[model samples]
Target chain A: MRRQLLFTALGAAIALTSPLAGAAGDELNFDAYREMLADGNPAELLEMEGEELWRTARGPKNATLEQCDLGRGPGVVEGAAAQLPRYFADTDKVQDLESRLMHCMEAQQGIPSAEIINGQFLKGERGKLAALVAYVVTHSKGKPIAIDLSHPRVKEMYDMGERAFRYRTGAMDFACSSCHSQDGKRIRATQLPNITKPEGAAEGWSSWPAYRVSNSQFWTMQHRLWDCFRQQRTAEPVFASDVTIALSVFMAGKGNGAEARWPGVKR
Target chain B: MKKLFLALPLALGLSGASADELQTRVEQMMLDSFKANGIAGLDRQKQDAVQKACSGLTPPDAETMKKLEAAEMATIKWPTDGNFTGGDWKEGQKIAASGRGLTWTDKTADNNGGGCYNCHAMDPKEVSEGTIGPSLEGYGKLRGSSEEVVKYTWGKLWNSKAYNACSDMPRNGYGGILTETQIRHVMAYLFDPASPVNQ
Candidate 1:
């Protein structure tokens, strides 16, 4: 894979330039360097694989996920991710992209619900959930988030998510707001996006289903939330649970109207 | 007049119940939402008294904070040998810079990173250090070891919340994030003249 080559090349590059980064009073300009690498991001590979999986038919039902209705309708993935964690009338529950995909996987493709829900994100080699999420989110590229808060369930979820955002109960006493509420904050070399305001939330919300260079795999919003809780030292949230959906509703609502840039690349 | 007084108090209680109910629901949902997997377990959902107080809409009162601080202070296990800066600076550097441990991905909990670089500038040479906490670049150079300074520094490392109730820093000692030997190494990384942090 090109990513494998990129990693090899980068390793050599780091080895050669190790002396410069090790000097006294040297600012690595790592953020700018990351920006340069972002241009030819290898997320394109996952996007290609996702497109194939989305269109191809597999599983017991032997049917494509193309018929899986996101928010707009069946097979209408365009801009659907942005509007999600919204209430679906049929399911009668607010659902994010991963939960909805799980629904379609079981209902349409005949995959066992347990099979999909059991895997912990990033605990092992990347799960199929990450691949499927990458496929679905790529469809909504270059669109604005449009969460529907009118539905009663959606309204309830949004309220719960707001509380969840500020609900700081962990070994370290961290909430989503602890790290994300403040702007211009970083954890080591990484700059954390503030999810409090629309502009900040836009940057935060719309860039998941991203390719991670560290592990050479893609991550979804579900995995992203899971990691936040991990770093917060909270209980690992179950896949597609009410709490995860509630947090999604809160973030998606905050990030409303921001452009959806998925299959994103991260260092 | 009697009916009005009773009704008003009932209404106030009902309003209070709504927020209480939401809190209970979210807490229960969190308990139900996660399961024990790998090294992480459901017990992590359970919050301690300090965690519970900090989770509230308002900060804990000074009286409550003093009690919590006292409890936290008791958890710090001071090195019996009375040597704080005896560990190797190279080993200390590795522990201070590491940010991985206790997550599901990790196989074991031993040798967890202090994650100090994530929030503090340990050395002036590193550009990538975080700014959430104050810089400690010349920590030893600035403050030479009086018995008072050494003891205070060791206490701060053991339980930061013992000094500040709502510190963003983890109760590294009380929370069991690092071991006594590891903390000693970190202390050396801070106090040793040969360490880059002192330079």
Candidate 2:
């Protein structure tokens, strides 16, 4: 009995001391780890797959997305992703990359937009859409973010987005600014960037279509935006909604001149 | 015999002194080993006054804690329009699930992710979520959208330190990690009945 009691005490002591003892002075060596993994980012594979999807003619209409215009000329995919959330004269609406992809899937491939939008991120034809995004965004890698705000609609959307950003409601009465409007702040160990500053906006706006280590899946900008709503415990924004595009525009515009780093790796 | 006994006591004292010296040396060595890069700088290693007080210490006195919280609250930038709760919830949902942007390799121009799921369980249906923060499922159902609630929520997001001086929650708005519109969408996602978070 005494031995068992001593063992239990020892176990309790070990548990209590382990985390405190281990965490005393060891900080995360992020730079060294990042350097080691830089050469073999999994985003490379997704980019290759996306390229194939963009060129391959496999839709119901047996058409390819090669002719899709992402704010550039027809069939242009290079550096287009960095300039999206812009007004498309053809659609008479501002669209982001995902929304544009839906348009191409419907117009060129004869596939229904609803079907493509409804499908899972990596399942069926929608998966192909994700791959296409990966490929297109990768082409814009290292390019400067140059979202066009010269258009009247673009300016209007920016204003609207600003208002929406400050709007607060819900059980917790949380607003986006509540978590994002400060500097030198952190949640757990993750530092929160201030979106109001140029450096912060630039740093915060240009990396997207990243692979989430926890989910083991690739996430586009659309997916990234939608998930924020979930945490807010608010209504789920529609897929490719105008408000969503406007927010994208607002963020991208703020991050002007920031280099694009799509298909990025994330912890 | 007297000389030998005196030497043993002195030797013991010297050994204790050496142990303390070793501890200090190790602590200094650890502090010097780190290097800053990109958005992450060496300043991160240094703790604020509140953090230093809290570090390896007991909880702070109420008066000191209140003072720190007040200082943090002063940093909040309230919305100019006085509008709270107008963004579509659907858009908010998209923002919550994303955990992208802001790393050593990431360019200064990229969009940063909220990475909410890395800490909190927002949706009951989501099987994969970290436990760092409390589960936020049914947040709207449990609490209604009121003016006080709305303002508080905004305050929390704009500067979590306003509420809790040493809160683990990030200051999203103040930090520029998220834009105003993105925050609006996130707010909608939490309140909208049709949102997955509510469901």
Candidate 3:
């Protein structure tokens, strides 16, 4: 009778855990299918158009983005996107690619930053900015994510981001950490990566400017961060805001050495 | 009197007035309690056939489950050109990391993210990742470049329900979360030996 009981208990255990064990195989198949569609990504067209916009003189002053400095020297576009959300001495604030781009448009091209930020992603001058970012970010593809937090201001932003990540408030009492701090958590089958660990940070930070399959549109890093704030039920993030850049610094700094894969695809 | 007593038990069993009824009633109550606002509508409360099947007290029976899986398989949208792999891996990595777009507050749906990190571990050095899925550390290394592997990943992303009838994964491609180009880049992030996911 004891032996029979043991066998029954074992069967129950297997039944309970089988779903978790089977999930790995299911995910592998999904990954493979996504791989097959990698070629001829439509985002390429956006990248190309973005490249043209970068060099073309536009805005009130009709200045090209080629003269913009992305922390590298002026006119140097290589690998600049990888080391963003860094401290810019001139601005005296931590800035990422989008914010820095806004500064360039305002100061260099004489276009008001408000006009661009107020517009939608693909509308008016904001669309032009998105294209420019798409073009610029693609150039740094395959490089490692290496945000510099060595500066005191950059470090301060990283610390602020860490605090923001853990600050739990809202109807669901959700912070970024609520969904991202734990391993093996899921909401309606959607897996949530633990963002507190190195692998998670690298994976999370490396893919931005991705094409969202759900909406059939490309998203930039700025848009990506803003959406996170919205999901947290926090106030909508200001476009190219410092808090957003700080979060980028925190994720990118943690993701050191992870290869940059911008313009990624997503479900 | 004797017939009534016999019929009472039968009625209880046939009517499913036990645990199953209680569970369904609870779910209904929960669904009804929530109100739809803005872009979020009552449709969110409605479960599809697959969801209903999965929510049952027991796992789906094998025969019915097989039929559901087949139905999901039919929904996959394979690339027309047959070019399964393209786009720069660097570009792909960015999309995987971002978890943005698709909410009631979103003014527009022009930009969105893959939110891949919400589930699986992709890179070795990074600190934050969710573990709902397996550690994708060295995915390319473990599974070499075989045609079968490539095709399977693409299909899974397109419609996860194809393989597993009640899979928790979002139907990225089928549900229109990521575009073809975006899917391509995410593919590069996974399969590109150069991608950090591979490393």
Candidate 4:
């Protein structure tokens, strides 16, 4: 682990000293640093672990999630993330991959909902829900996001999502649109992705579940949204709640057709 | 009679409500989705007039913006002591550089950082400074602390939305983000000639 960190640091140091650095007035050099770290994203470990979790039988019901349907057929994992945040007939609601995963854990494996909700967000850690999500999303990598809006519930979610994105209420009065609607903006050396347009939203939404170097953590989209809500100074969103799924639908839909670039590296 | 009474429930389903039902349901969802922790309460999700207007899916018109700005500006609380630069610059520097505060994990409410460096280029030496807002590197040197400059700077830091209703910047004073003394320290950090911001 120490050696790996050294190699990562060396990559960062080399990129920081490059003449290309600071040319964009990005003296903090976050983009350059991220490019250097891209070679060995830590999210890879999580993906492998998620695959293990999907096949292993360790839960209360002694069942694996291999038979769980993710918008495709039962036990289907390929390209499922490409059309996520869709309506699930069993639950009769619109759900993102994480929400659906939670439902499966409860229904298929009989794992208590509360335990999964409060579970740690680690990659290799036991019962880490994010790791399983990583495994599922990995299959859909590079596929274009194609959210299905055929269901009326899906439309309702999308509509609510649009409203939620623009709704500003907090101590800071920051809506998601505040930092993202504009172009060429950064918050402390980090570029805020514009999630208002198809191209920008796709680019923004596509490269999530990134491996953050500063914290050495693999963050899923749900975790990313959690951080965003925290920064917005709003109440902590319940894990995989309707509001979260709706926002995912809104963003994933806007970014529809943007290639899924999962397990991205970040500073 | 019991059957008729039970049939009333089916009657409700037969009767249709508004097509705008999704919007109303989403509102309820929003209420149910979040929970308060630490210093942040659920009430933080309630929108003020300025926030409501500014958070439109489309940008509000100029006429709407003017009215919202006026309402937002009225919320700014000026320094009661009539002194904006009386606090220490060293403390100001820490506050300017910090981006921590008001989160659920945060321990206290009094030590919130201005997070100024998160969005503005403060000291030229601080390469990690953000570019979201304008640089204040030579604030005192470029624009001396004239009466108007001092007042305007103070107000800007207090309620950024006063001048620009839709600004991405937080309303530090109006939002209870910083105490007046902390704002005073930030004032000194900007205007003090000895501060690195000027050099």
Candidate 5:
């Protein structure tokens, strides 16, 4: 089968307006496809589930995440994810939204961090976390990415992230820069965003935590980064590790002022 | 090794010592963050001289480039048997097309793919090719199978950095990404008249 024709059985309407009919539609334009699925994004379902999980009283402590602080303040979900991967004074660690959420779950709800950390994606505790992520990022939709690198630790993470981006190792000898540093590049028809630049960083950073049509699952940014490392043929970074958070800090800080398009749909 | 960097700054009283400090810290961070899983291990995180040299913001100096290339060239394991293009082109097609192996979930390291199509266009019919490297559609047809051309191609596939110091192409043979027989098969896929790559 042609690679571009490998569209999933999501929307029957997509099949009707298939891009294959046109001469110029040889390759799938993800931008156009994203727009097509805008009204009916599957991430909305996960968002709803996340909202319920947020307010519900569960976990060992029998507490909801309603009082969890997401950088803005306790229980402030609006525009919070836009400025994530920031240094949290309470934890004294630079954390992304997922990592921050992990803290909240652990502290407020008495949920062990190990459960989510060691768990696989779209299953059990990790799966619930994915939903929560979808919910949290939904509030930050259309808000500018405003990461603060003023803190010394956050600055260190940003520096670490920049170095990590160029640090090529593994069997493939591939770095994030190998494919992403250049503009207008692709890996077998898929457009690789040039994440070094602000626009590219925004495009890459903001549109994730997405619902994938291929796998039929919502993937958090941690899952996305994990898979990137997997494809790089390097050892997997632990869930919400410093390396992952540092990489996030680099991308988010570089992507500051770009609008968040959270709960995105992807092929 | 860890203390050496910390001691250097204090000993020399250097003002801008954070460059080496950052490198050390990042290396330690990677070691701490990543854990070995199945086929993939923490050992892969450690960068060799060639990898480290090429990973810098700028390419290594001309002298260093030559040294790196020479060192990489020494690592290529040339086919013991003179016959390079005798392998099946059909098997080569599968090897080039696949982008699997060495990942954590992968069962074993053997039978890994060359992942050629990820960067270069091999078969004209295969539209799912990346434009990172030049197209190899008419590789054999354009460059005939002379002894020099065959040897050059073999070495190139084995370790691309041998020819170009910081070539983006992976060191397939030197890196143990593909086996000798698998590379031979890929050679056939590139040079064989019956191969779709030539057509």
Candidate 6:
């Protein structure tokens, strides 16, 4: 696959440049391991299913989502996911990919938003949505993440999102910042990215909608954030809520100009 | 009354809201976004005074930190039997290794993990230990079980904020995340000569 080739090429480049020693060398080795696992990611199977669903007519209206608008106009799958969490005029609100999909599924396919809003991850409507998310983000692979923060509402959401990032609560007294505000830290063995910085935010934001090897399931960004709050010992957030969108805006906006590596493979 | 005050600005529009007003809006938005499920309730979103002081963009001033630490120190419950590090180190090792409990999936509060290994190295041989907190690989060997050391360890485990106001470490005893017996076991795990942490 293209990503495998890219990783192999990157690994070779790093091997040629840096002397194999210390943390950087360890990181290069980890990347090589990741490249090995990333070959034939399980999310690819889901992506294929999503592509089929996108073209198939099966919703209440018996309509395919081929005409669904993803902020690049109707049926425009190319590079659409790169510029999402944008202000949508039709709904008079800012929406990320999943929420926008909820709209399109409702308006174009006659499927209700509640089907996903109340649904569990990788089950029922949510499962279908995850597949669709995989298909959509794959189009934006290696594209620069460029979310617009010009809209007043969007700017407001971004500010609030930054606040939410630092808002510590729950039994453990954790904000998203608790784990993510620093670089080169880990929770147990898993690496944590410092989402306050550009590179780290991009690493956190763009690499998700990933295939999680541990659970053997594809996790969209919403699913990832939901579990983050769960681990923080907080209450369950409603699916695709404004708070989630706001947090997405903060991340994507901060990560502006970084490459999106959606449908990423993860441990 | 508090809900109405928080909700009023967002009802009109957040366009003209101040930084403080926007913070209030974000808090309300969080309150609106989450719902109680299983044992995890919406009340978990509520921040205590100590949590509020620490959740700022920067750490609170030194005076406020001292006050907060003092208040937190008052909450520590020293072992009633005056026996510290008396429990089995084996049980403590299990508690230290577990990163479970308090999530919605967990059925009971009594069965919980110290989650110590999630942030600190217990046994020197454990390669997967986290680096968030200092490594405690040879806690007993390095800092012998003097009266002062034992008492400080007990208080720190009970309420980490008692020592540092904004420590990332959880209040294992104060938060009721671990029981008294559990804490005692973890103490032994750190101090016991037979424990792998000391070996």
- Choose the strongest candidate by DockQ: 5
Two-chain DockQ for each candidate model: 0.34, 0.02, 0.03, 0.40, 0.46, 0.44
> What does DockQ come to for candidate 2?
0.02
Residue ranges of candidate 5 with Cα displaced over 4 Å:
A1-9, A17-26, B1-17
Model 6 chain A poorest ten-residue lDDT run: A19-28
Write out the backbone clash pairs for model 6. Answer: none
Off by over 4 Å in 6: A1-30, B1-14
Q: List the residue pairs that clash in candidate 5.
A: none
Chain B TM (all candidates): 0.88, 0.78, 0.83, 0.84, 0.89, 0.91
lDDT of 4: 0.80
- Residues A128-154 of candidate 3 have per-residue lDDT tens digits of 777778877887899988876555566
Q: In model 4 chain A, which range of ten residues has the least summed lDDT?
A: A118-127
CA shift of B53, model 3, Å: 40
Supply candidate 1's per-residue lDDT for A92. 76
Instruction: Identify the superior model by lDDT, candidate 1 or candidate 6.
Output: 6
lDDT of 6 by residue, A182-216 (tens): 87887776788899999999999998989875556
- Write model 1 residue lDDT over B136-172, tens digit each, in one string: 9988889997788888888888888788776778878
Query: What's every prediction's RMSD, in angstroms?
Result: 5.5, 23.8, 23.4, 6.4, 5.6, 6.1
lDDT of 2 by residue, A79-188 (tens): 89888878888998878898898999899988898887556557876777787888888889899998876665665556555544543432122445545667655443
TM-score of each: 0.85, 0.54, 0.54, 0.87, 0.92, 0.91
Between candidates 2 and 5, the DockQ winner:
5
Q: Is candidate 4 or candidate 5 better by TM-score?
A: 5
Candidate 6 local lDDT, B124-161, one digit each (tens): 87767677899999999999999999999999998999
Residue-by-residue lDDT tens digits, candidate 4, A62-158? 8989889998999999999889989888998788888888888888888777776765555222236788878888899889899875455666677
Across residues B142-197, which tens digit of lDDT does each residue of candidate 5 receive? 99999999999999999999998788899889888898989999999999999999
